[model samples]
Target chain A: MNNRQILSAAIGSLLALGLVSNASAAGKKMDMEQCYGVAKTGHNDCSSNKSAHSCAGQATKDRDAEDFVAVPKGTCAKIAGGTLKSA
Target chain B: MEKPANDSLPCIAGIGLRAPHYCEVLEKLPKLGWVEVHNENFFGGGASLRTLLKVREHYPVSLHGVGMGLASTAPLDQAHLSALCRLCDAVQPAAVSEHLCWNSVPDMTINGPMVINDLVINDLLPFPYTQEALSHVARRVDQVQEKIGRRLLVENLSSYLSFTSSEMSEGEFLSELSRHTGCAILFDVNNLYVNARNLGVDAKAFIKALPAEAVAEYHLAGHSIRDGCLVDTHSTQVCAEVWELYEFALQHIGPRPTLIEWDSDIPVLAVLTGEAEKAQQRLEEYHACFK
Candidate 1:
């Protein structure tokens, strides 16, 4: 697949895992996100020992966005409080 | 953006350069040898990249990636590699590295008759250590290095489980990987400690297996016990035992750029500064030995 397809696939996985949100953008511009949520067992972004704010102490309530994922652009706006973290 | 590009990281101690400490670091310009950061955090151009560029203006930065999943069975993620390329082009980091563990895989199951393949992003998970696995990892490392236009440093993992079908230890796997692909070793001491505590891995033996020059960086962190298993939490002071293991690494693997990683329950900047200072002392002693 081409770059856009490759990017979309990666971001799609991140969105599926709920690590990032999905948002639509102008022209098929592929974007990735740094989203928060409990991504994996050993692989959550940073341990969410505290409330969500930054990478440090990113622990959230049960199954929240504790894991940071590279999601497609425009996805995070759909995620409540999920800011677009990356391209 | 106007600061001179740092050629290399000093054989001294550095911190992970988390967001919490960015402002303080940029303002104070404290006495740190260098700084390391998570590559993904600065993937896109924005305030984060701007802040990183400012940080780059002062000290050398090491780009450490947590989500590369180099060993996953699925095809390598090109977008991730592209983002890294862009980041490297912008930051001109002293070192770029990723973990040896596999963090994602293609999901394969069936709805009774059909199969599905979904990319499963995970924390670093265990994989076999066979020649086949080694070949796969080396090929991926080569792809990454070729894309980034530099030698990538692959780190050791702090595993909670073991693969009985594995053909070699993690150290051996890393050593052979380095030898085959010419990638260097990041040599995370705390990871070895966690594995040993949790899986009876021999830390000293692992260090002995490495080629000294291949060890380009060292990671020092703290671990917490979860259900009686050690976790590479990176959330506290560098414990005394981990420090001892680090000393062992320095003695065996020799002095390299070391980083103090504290991710969770991050305390004040002073706390990380103190931890870095401790690591700095160990580094100094290692250098003094040659003097």
Candidate 2:
């Protein structure tokens, strides 16, 4: 098959398998907000500002200083001590 | 509305935009001169690229790369290069930069065809600063600039140890590399400070040796000291000593686009902005000296 034909078949297979469509659909509706002060120790999304750990899952305290979790907007405030802005 | 693309980096203070602050920065649109992000993070089309594009709409973006491995003996990673090219096309970044270090090497061949698989160290590894290495790095820089169609800014590395085999200083090697490839320099003051503390590098002499005209930008980051060795962890505020060295650099190299980079233990958006504001104050102070 020609290069164009090969490319078309590969993309067609991805579409038929719902991989491309699923990713496209997911990308369109991103509403996740960073909910701060709620993540358990060693359970944060990425890095922390007040802690020595730089990578994910390295927080040393339960009430992390600057670590966060991604939750839907307006729900973070409902959790006790959770704020949109970092403490 | 999509903001017009800006190809020139403003000589002002900015923060390194990490993943945690993306949502907040996008939502609030804080006043900033510019912002930089690791180019490798947004190589694919998804939420990450989408958010970066949205950031491009507000502030000029600079693409800082960590995985280019410019001095690697192995052939340049074409796939990584192509991805970076596509990212530049999409973002129209004000600047593009990579570290002056090696990451991978070719497969080892022992006596009588005993071959070992190639290894990628996956970290910024330093090499001896010699004429041979200089020529090799210069050739690689030429290839990268040709592929990207722009001058690549090479940042000096923060090494923990010095090589006895090195024939020249890191600053001299960088100067020769810029002279050979016509590339620019991204002088990281914090990296220099770390080298000074850890390896007893002469920070002042290194700064004086650099080709001031080739310096296109400056980087300021915080580091941590462990067991008498300073590590460029970028997890805290820029220390007083690094700031002093930065002022020395400003006096020598002149004011340039400076960035406050906090990678590990990423801080709150306000803290990052506060750090950027401190850098802005220093830049203005230096600029007022001439005016």
Candidate 1's residue-wise lDDT over B1-291, tens digit each?
Answer: 011223377888888877666666766789888998888877777556766777888898998887788898888888989999999999999988888877665666677856667566556677888999999999999899888878888988878788889999888898899889888889888888888888898878888888887788888888777667777777778888988988888888777878888887778888888898988888888774221
Which model scores highest in DockQ?
2
Q: What is the lDDT, from 0 to 100, of the residue B67 in candidate 2?
A: 83
lDDT of 1 by residue, A1-87 (tens): 999999999999887876333343421232112221222123433332222222221233355565757565776678876875555
DockQ-based CAPRI category assigned to the predicted complex of candidate 2: incorrect
Residue-wise lDDT of candidate 2 within B53-168, one digit each (tens)? 88899999999988889999989999999999999999999999999999888887779698766567777778999999999999999999889888889999888888899999
TM-score of the second chain in each model?
Answer: 0.94, 0.94
Which stretch of 10 consecutive residues in model 2 chain B shows the poorest summed lDDT?
B1-10
Model 2: CA > 4 A from native = A1-87, B1-7, B109-115, B288-291
Q: What are the lDDT scores of the predictions, listed in order? A: 0.76, 0.82
